[model samples]
Target chain A: MWSRRTLRQREELIAYLLVSPWVIGFLAFILGPMLTSLGLSFTETDLFTLEFIGFENYTKLLSFDATRTLFWTTLYNTAYYVFLSIPLTISVGFFIAILLNQNISAQPTYRVVYYLPAVIPGIAASLLWLWLFQPEFGLINWALSLFGIEGPRWLFDRKTAKMALVIMSVWGAGSNMLIFLAGLQGIPTELYEAATIDGAGIWRRFRNITIPMISPTLFFVVVTQIIWSSQVFTNVYVMTEGKGGPANATMMMVLYLYRVAFREYRMGYASAYAWIFFLILLVFTLILFRSSKAWVYYETEIGGQRS
Target chain B: MSGAAIGVGTARTSVKRARRTQVFLIHTLLIAGGIIVMIPLAWMLSTSLKPPHQITKFPPIWIPDPFVWSNYVRAVTIFPVSFLVFVRNSMYMSLMITLGTVLSNAIVAFAFARLSFRGSRVLFFIVLSTMMLPQQVTMIPLFILFSRIGWINSYNPLIVPHFFANAYFVFLLRQFYTTIPRELDDAARIDGCGVIGLFLRILLPLSKPALGITAIFAFTWSWNEFLGPLIYLSRMETYPLAIALSFLRAAHGVLWSELMVVSFIAMLPPVLLFFVAQKHYIQGIVITGVKG
Candidate 1:
C-alpha cells in the first residue's frame, strides 16, 4: 500500500497536472494577452515588429477626429443598445415567464415557440430581419401598411439601424426567458397560496413574493445581458454589410475596434480603444455588483438550501 | 394554486367562470405571441421554396407556386465555396473542439471539484472570472499570436484553444461534479481506487448528462462561430456554414430564394439538435449553461 505522505503528494501532483491546461491557457490566452494588450496599447505592431510609442495611441483618440468620432459614435450606439436591450429583454422575458407559469394548456408548445428565436444563428437571424425590416416588399412593412402605419426603413436608415439592432436583440431574449421560467418553477408555490389566503390579488402576490424570490435570477440575467449586449458584433457586422455603416450609425464598440485593428492596421490604437472599452465595462460591472446587495436576494441567506 | 393548494378546495361558480376566462385569455395571448415570434422562421422556409420573382412580390406570397426545389441546388452551387466543404469543416472542427473541450474541461473540472490542492479555490475563481472577460478583449492579441505562428487559415487556430479547458464549461462540469456525494469517493477508495480511478470510474460514469450538455454546448458554439473563423480562416475551403452563409449573403445580396435555401441549410443542425435533444436542451438552459 502507498504511504499517506506519498499518496498526498501524488494527489497534489495529479491535481496540478489536471489543471495544467487551464494554467497554460490562462498564461497564454488570457493573462498574457491581457498584459500584452496593455503593452500593445503603448506600442505599435505591424505583425513583424512592435514599436513602443507611449500613450501616443491613447492621445490619437482625442487628437484625431476620425478616431475620436468613431469612438464616440460607437460608444453612443453601444451604450444605447445596452441600456435599451437589458431592461426590455428582462421585463419581457419575466412577464412571459409569469404567463407561462400560469395554469395554461399546451405549455410545451408555447415554450418551444418562444425559445426558437434564441436558437437561430445570429447570421441567419440578421438575414431574416434584414428582409423583414425592408422599406418595401418585406413582411413587416407590408403588415404595417395593412394597419395604415408606415414602417421605418430599418437597417438602411441610419436613424433606425440601432433601434433595429436593439429590437432584434429583444426578440432573442428567450434565453433569459428560459432562466426566468426555471426561477419561477423554483419559487415555492406555498408562498403564493399563503398570499392568496391573506386576500392578496395576483398583482400583490407577484409584487411581494414573486419578485423578491426571483431577484437573484434578475441579477444574473442583467449582468449576463450587459456583457452580451456590449459585445454585439455579428448582427451589426452582417446587417451593415461589414461596414458598420449608414454613416457609422450602427458601429458598436467591438466593431469599431475590429475596424481599427484588422482593417486599418492600427493595432496600437485599437489596443488603446480596447483597454478603454474594458475599463468602461469593468466600471459598469463593479457598479452593478455594488448595487446588487440592495436587490439581489440569496435563498441561502434566508435559510433555503441553494446558495 | 390559490384554490387547490389552499384549504378553499373549490372555487364558487362565479369565481370558476372568471378563472375559465382568465385561462382562456392566457392561452389566447400566448398563442398570439407564439405566432408573432415564429413568423420570421416561417418566412424563411416560405422564401426558400419560392420562385425568384415571387420573393419580392408585394403581397408577400406565403407559399411558393410550383416550389422551386432547384433553389437548393443553385444556392449550394453558386457559392465559390462548397456547402459540403463547409459542413465537413464545421463537423470536423466542431467534433474536435467538442471532444477537446469536454475532455479537457471535465478533467480540469474534476481536479477543481475533487482534488484539494494548494491554490485550487483561487484557480477556480480565476476560471469564474474568465467567464466575465469578453472575447473581444482577447481576440486581437490571440489572432496576432496565431497568425505569427501561421495558424491563421487552419483548424489549429480554431481547435487548439479548446484543448485548454473553457472557463464556462469547466464551471458547469465542476458544478456537476460537486453534486456527486463525497461518500462515493470514500466507497471507491475502500476498494483501492486511486484519484484517477475515482474520477474515471465513479464521477465520469455518473456524469453522462453533464458531458452530453457540455458536448452539445461546445459543438453548437463551434458550429455557429462566425467571427473566429472569419478572422482566422480566410480560405474558401476552410469556411464553416456560418461564414459561407455570409459569403452567399454578400455576393447575391438580393437573391432571396437562394439566400433562404442557404439560410435553411445553415440553420438545420442547431435546430435539429434542439429538436433531438429537447429535454437535455431545456435542462442545460435551466441549469445555467453559461450564457453565450
Candidate 2:
C-alpha cells in the first residue's frame, strides 16, 4: 500500500517512529514541566488552589527582606560550598592522577583503592562521614590527637561544618581522578620525551606540554564539578538530618527548595526559586563554554583536522 | 682507560640509585594516600563488628574484640518489616528502571545515530541541551503532575520517566552506535533485515559494552536514588534502602554498630558490581569526559 513512497521517505517515517518515545518524553517530562514551573512561578498554588500573583515570588525572594526569606543566605552557602569543594576535589584528583600515571608497580590496584570511596552510595558515605566527623570519638579527631592537636567540633559547629563537608567531598575526588588519569594517559609520551630532549626540566615540561594537553579535560572536570557541587543535596541532607542546620550554615538552594515545596507546601515560591537557580546554572555553563576557546586545547585543531 | 671505566660504573650505579629512590617515594606517597582514603571503610567494618561497649572507646578500636557478627543479623531483624523488604523494593525499582532506560534510550539513540530523518540534528542538539536543565527546574511541577495523575506514593513517578529516555544515556549510546560501520547496516538491509532486526540482531550484540555501561549506570542511579523515593514512596514497606536507612537513623538514636551494618548491606550490591565491571565503569566515565 505504501510502495509508491520512496525508500528514503519510508525510512524517515520509521526513524520518526523509533524516536517518538524520546520526543513524547521530552515534551511530557522535561519541556512540559519546565513551562508549567515557569507559569507556576507567577501564581500561588497548593495543587488545589491557584491564585495569579504576578512576580510576587521573585520579588519577595529578591527583596531586601532576606533575613526572613533566606534567599541570599542559601545562595551564598551554595556558592561557598561549590567554590570551596570544586578546587579541592579537582586539585586532589589531579594530583592523584599525576602520581598514578608514573608507571608504578600495581597501578591498577592503587587506582582501585583511590577510586573505591567514590563507589560508595551517597547515603552510606554521608552516614559514615557523619560518624567520622563526630567531635570526640571519631577517627579524624583521634588522628589529630595523635599529632598533639585537639580537633575542632566538625559537623556540630557551624564554622567548621561546611569545611567538614568540603573535606568529605575530597575523599571521593577519586572519580574525578579517574577522569583526569584517563586524560593524562591520552597525552602522547613522545611529546614528553621530546620535551626532555629539548632540555625542559620537570616543571617546564609540565607547564608547556602537560597543562595544554589536558586543558580540555580540566575544562570538563571544572564544569561538571561546578554543576555537581552546586546541586549537592544527598550528603548534606543525610549528614545534617535534612535540616541544613548549625544555624542554616549548610542551607543550599536545592535543600531549601525541597523544604519550601514539600515541607512548607509553598510550591509556587519554590518554583520561582527553581527558575532562578536554573538561570544561574545556565549562565555559568554558558560562560564556561564561551571561555573554553581561550583555554581548552584541541590537538585535532593543531593537526588541521576538523573532527 | 681503567679510570674512565670506573667513572662510567659509578655514574650507572648513581642513576640506578636515583631510580630506586623515585620508585620508593612514589610507592610511599601512594600507600599513605591509600591508607588515609581507606580509613572510613576500615572504620565502618571495624565498628560494625565491635560490641556496643567498644564503639565509643577513645583512640577508637581498630579491631573489634569477640567480633560481634550478630550486628548484621540484628540490623536486618530490627526493622518493623523484614529489612529484605527494602532490598526487594530497591531491586525491583533498579531492575525496572535499568530495563526501561536501556531499551528506550538505545532505540532512540539508534534512530539519531543511524537514521537520516529531518530535524534529527536539531532534535539531538535539543536533547543534549536538556542535559543542562537540572531536575530542580521540573521537580515541583513533576510532583504536582504526579499528584494529579494519582501516581503519588507509587513507583510510576520514579520508574516511568526513564522509559522516555534521558539525555545522558541517549548521548552515550548514540556515540557508541555511530562507531559501527555503515557496511553492516547495508548488508543487513540487502538481506531484507528491517531496522528493528538490525538493532536486535546486529547492533545490540555488538554494543554490549555500551549497553552494559548504561545498564550499570541506570541500575546504580536507581539503587542510590534518595530524593525521588523520599518524595514518591511514603509507605514504610515501599521505602528503598536509602530512605529506610535514614529512617533508622532518625527514628532511633544512632545505633552505631547496627547502622554501619545496614549501611554496608545497602552499599554492597553496587560496590560488588563496581568491582566486577571496573573497566566498563571507567570506560563509561572516560567516554563521558572525552565526548562532552
Candidate 3:
C-alpha cells in the first residue's frame, strides 16, 4: 500500500492537473487582458500612438469639453435604468412566482408561457420589441386606441424611449421569477403550518416567514440585476444604432464605450471608461455585500444571522 | 382558535366572500399581466405574416388578412449569403462549446467537490470571483490577443474558450457533485478504482442532471452570443445566425416584413431546445439561486 503522504501528494497532483486548463486560460486570456486594460486606462492611446499619460484619460473624461457631457449622460441613463428595473423586476417576479406556486391548474403551461421570452436570444428579443414599439403602425398604439388612450411615440420620443426599454426588460423577468419560485418552494411546509397555528394571516406569514426564508435569493437577484442593467448594451446598440438618441435619452455607458472603441478607435479612452465603470460596480457590489448581513438569512443558523 | 371567537359568524360569511372576490381579482390581474407580457411576441408573428402595404397601414393590422408564406421565402433569399450556412455554423460552434464546457467543467468540478487539497478553497473562490468581472473589460485585450494568435476571423475565439471551463458552470457543477454520497467514492476506491476511474465509472454516471443542465446553458449562451462573434469573425462565411440576422437588418434597413421573418427563424433553435429541456432548465435556474 502507498504511504499516506504519497497518496495525498498524488491527489494534489490530480487536482492541479484537472484545473490546469482553467488556470492557463485565465492567465492568458482573462488575467492578461484585464491587467492590460487597467494599465491602458492610465495611458493616452490613439491610432498611431500610446504613452503613459498618468491620469490624463481620467482627467479628460471628468473635465474635457465633449467627453464630460457624454460621461455624465451615460451615467444618468444607466443609473435611471438600474434603479427602475431592479425593483420592478423583483416585485413582478416575486408576485408571479407566488401565483404560480399556488395549487393552480395548468401550472406547467403557465410557466412555459412566462419563460418563453427568457430563452429567446437577446438580439432577437430586442428586434421583436423594436417592431412592437413602432410609433405609427405599432400594435401597442392600436391596442391603446380601443381604450381611447393615444400612446406616445415610444422609441422616437426621448421621454418614453428609456421607459420602452424598461418595458421590454419585463418580458424576461421570468428567469428571476423562476429563481424566486424555487426559493419559495424550498421553504418548509412546517414553517407555514406553524405560522398558521400561531394565528398568522397570509400577509403575516409572508412577512414573517416567507420573506426571511427567501432573502438570500432576493439579494442575489438584486445584485446581479443591478450589475446587468448598468452594463446594458445589446438592446441599445441594436435598437438605437448606438446613437443614445432621441436626444441621447437612451445612451448607456457600454454603448458609449462601444462607440468609442470600435467606431472612433479611441482605444485608450474607452479602456479608461471601462475601468471606471468596473470600479463603480465593484464599489456598489461591496456595499451590497456589507449590507447583506442585515437582511439575508441563513437557514442553518438561528436568529436570522449571516453565514 | 378563531373558530371559537366568531360567534357572530355571518360577518365571517361576508368576509369570506370578500376574500373570494380578492382571489378572483388577483387571478384576473395575473391573466391581464400575462397577456401584456405576450403582446410583443404575438405582434411579431402577426406583422411577419402581413403583406408589405398592410405592415404600416393605419390602425395597424393586428392579424394578417392572408398569412404571407412568401415573406419567409423572400427573407431566406434576401440576404446574399445562404441562411443554411449560418445555421450550420451556429449549430457546429454551439455544439462544440456545449461539449467542451461540459467535459472540462465537469472534470474540474469533480476535483473541487470530491478531492481534498491545500489552497482549494481559495482557488475555488478566485474562480467564482472571475464571474463578477464584466466581459467588456477584457474584450479589447482579448481581441488583440486573438488577432496576434491568428484566431480572429475564425470560430477559435468563440469555441476554444469553452475548453477552460466557465466560472458559473464550474461553480454550479461543483455544488451538484458535492451532493453525491461520499460512500460511493469510498466503495469505489476499495475496489481499486483510481481517481479518474472513480470519476468516469461512478460519478459521471450519477451526474446526468447536472451534465444536462450545463449542456443546455452552454448551448443557449453560445447560440445567443453576438458581441464575441461580431468582433472576432470578420468573414461572411464564418458568421453565426446572430451575425447573419444583424446583417439582414442592416441590409434591409429595418424593413419590418423581412426583419420579422428573419427574427422568427433566428429564434427557432433556442425556443425548440427550451421546450425540449424546459423542466430541467427551470429547475437549474431555481435551484442554483435558492441553494447558493
DockQ of each: 0.48, 0.40, 0.38
TM-score ranking from best to worst? Answer: 1, 2, 3
Residue B278 of model 1, lDDT score: 63
Pick the lDDT winner.
2
Chain B global fold similarity (TM-score) for predicted model 2 against the true chain B: 0.91
What TM-score do all the candidates reach, one by one?
0.95, 0.95, 0.94
In the range A32-116, model 3's lDDT, one tens digit per residue, is: 8989998888877754578888888888887747635488888889998888888887898899988876644456666777778
Give the per-residue lDDT digits (tens) of candidate 1, residues B102-196.
98999999999999899998988889888888877777788889998889889998899899998888888888888899999999999989999
lDDT digits (tens) for residues B1-292 of candidate 2: 1111111212233457778898789899999999999989999999999999899999788889989999889888888998888999999999999999999999999999988899999999999998777899999999998998999878899999999999999988998888789999999988988878998988989999999999998898889998899888888989989999988878764688888998898899998998898877777776676221
Candidate No. with top DockQ = 1
Error of 1 at B123 (Å): 0.9
**Model 3 Cα shift for residue A100 (angstroms):** 1.0
Candidate 3: give the clashing pairs. none
The regions of model 2 sitting more than 4 angstroms off are A1-5, A302-307, B1-16, B290-292
Query: lDDT tens string, model 1, A1-307?
Result: 7799988999999999999999998899899998888889999886777899998888876554873547777888999999998888888888888888875666667777788777677888888888788788889889988999988898889898889988888788777777787777777878989989999998888778888889888888888788878999889888888898898889899988888888887788888888888888888888989998877878667654323
lDDT per residue for candidate 3 within B130-191, as digits (tens), equals: 87788889877777677778887889998998998878888889888887899999999999
Instruction: Evaluate model 2: give its TM-score.
Output: 0.95
**Model 3 chain A worst lDDT run, 10 consecutive residues:** A298-307
